[model samples]
Target: MKVIKKMSMTMALIAASATAAFASGQQAEEISYYEPGASIESIVVDAAGKGQVGNWGLGNEYEVQALLTKYGQPTTYLSQAFDMDGFDDDSILLASAMTYNELGLVKNSYDGGYSYGEGVSYIDMNDEGVAMLEDNLFTTAAFAAENPETVKAFIYASMKGWAYACENPEEAAEIVFNYGSSVSPEHQAYMAEQVKKLVETDTMGNMVRDYGKMDEAAMAQTLELAKTYIKLEDSVAASALEAMSLEDVMDASYWEMAMGSSGAFSPEKSEVSIQLKWLPQSQFMGYYVALDKGFYEEVGLSVNIIPGGGDIGETTAVYTGQVDFGVTWVSNLIAANAGGMGLLEVAQVYQRSGLVLVYKTN
Candidate 1:
């Protein structure tokens, strides 16, 4: 049976070569392998055919699988955008690509960690990307202006998703695993339990139960922190930075909409859906819960979750009507706003950043 399989594969390769020749004037080729003491000419021909050098003996199923995995496709546009190495790593890149694709961008060759330019810092391009994002901020501003209530609902849903993940790590893990199958089931379960412990012990525990609620105080703290890191120039007032206090950013009217009150902000009357850009982790839960539990439907929303990574282009996503909401550090957002992206803070998810740069401690 094994011999038959090998013969069949060889025949298929020959047929493929013949077809290529017929279509594009290429030559037919064959792969050869040798045992110990084989002729040098035999070895050279074999190496050229397989696009490799030296003797690798016979091809196995593993080699075939590797070819399928490696040379299977091309890189995508979003893949080029997030430029994962420029941000963090492959995981972040995959997450970002998934988010943007979900939010309705043209699909391209997207594998997780494709590096484009070497030593191009994400922080340095902040001005260029943010300038583009600033132009797109008008879309978000218009949405906020027209459907303030739905915006609040979207925030409530986001906060609720975070709180749910904290309260039920197992559930969150299941959700994340559904989208990201790369994580082992055992690891997913372990992560869920750990996240639960982290949230329960934190000062924000109470807020998790209340829809991952962010109050004016929390928003104020976030804005203050943004002011510390963001280099805002003369065009945006230092007071504009200060005015970003929780009171200016948070409008609860949207939550009222989800509750079906007369005061609810209705985008249907205006015919619009909010575009939300999600951090890979945040969207994982939101999608699993919203799809599984129907949270989005309950609120009368058609939420479009945009994935981000590589040159993730968060500013571009927001400024171009790709996403109305995005998960970003205050530093990034403040930079975007300063670059004139007009990105406003609707809520703050993480009080302390999970981001850390680690090297060998020793």
Candidate 2:
């Protein structure tokens, strides 16, 4: 698996490669890992083959614009201009690919051509050098300073939640759905399974026992790419973002504290809320499972799980201190950091990018 992954990563950097990403619960069984890069390429090429433009599978207008800039925007880029209704029937030549959920919708769609022989044509953002970390836990530096123990407890509780979810994805899926995930029950389950793969392993296919450790190297790569591809509104903002070092963006002491203490969770008690990136979904199953299973309570936290929506932005809410902690993508954080928001990452949930570029293969 290591050899294959290294080869895949090398090939992808040179040009592009047809890769397939698949996720099913391990369920006491070891499943083969997919090269995230190849899987992404297959999906993108599939969409492009059919004459569609490509972009990130998720993000708002601002983030999407950043994605286009990062990818060397296609001349026909128009994801927001048209919805998914008649994209396949018309000459829509671009579509954002999300490996975890939306891209799955395409493979299951009527008749999209594929690049990986029986698979599809796409490109993984990670491979294309635009891989940004997603679903990271973050908070304002003031909170960390005011309540260092509280920070440690939350990290411990959250890591427990993720570990449990990865090991028991079906149960985790049910928890996410019941927590108000707007997606169908089946879709939630699919997301649960995929997220499990990410939280449990590194991109190289090795098991990662440290559940919430931030990959500093990957984080650095994310920052560099964001600087190149994303343009901040003002030069000052852009300069601030470019000036940030990983130390400014991350404070790992709390995570280390959590790692040092491994006894059964026992806490006096504290209360706080965490805002998620979106409404209830399997992508955030770990936190939900923690809340549902009382892991937060075990760690002495009385957590108020705030669901995210149209008006509820994770980075903004965290920056304003509206929530004690927030779940968000690393790219958004970079944008905010560049714009003078002093948000810091506490825990990294997903080890790999689920975002991909999908296009028509025909």
Best by TM-score: 2
For 1-362, candidate 1 gives per-residue lDDT tens digits of 44765785677667767686543321222212234454333433333344332111111011122222233322111222323332232112111212122111112223332323232111111111111111011134556676576665565555556666766767877877766454355445554554343233323334233332334443444455455434445755565765554434444444434434432334443223333333334334544555456555555666655555445656567667766655544445655555556655554444322211110000
Report every candidate's CA lDDT: 0.40, 0.69
TM-scores of the candidates are 0.49, 0.76
Which 10-residue span in candidate 1 carries the lowest summed lDDT?
Answer: 128-137
Q: What TM-score quantifies how close candidate 2 is to the native fold?
A: 0.76
List RMSD in Å for every model shown. 16.5, 12.4
lDDT (Cα, tens digit) per residue for candidate 2, span 1-362: 44765784466444433332221221111212223454443433443434455443334333333445554453234453322433333334445555666665556532332213323355555556556677789998888887777888899988889999999999999998887867777777777887887777655456778988888887877667666656666989878877878887788887888878973444433888999887788888889999999988887789998988665678888888888899888878877887878888888888877766544443
What's the number of clashes in each of the models? 21, 34
Residue 295 C-alpha lDDT in model 2: 89
Query: Whole-model lDDT, candidate 2?
Result: 0.69
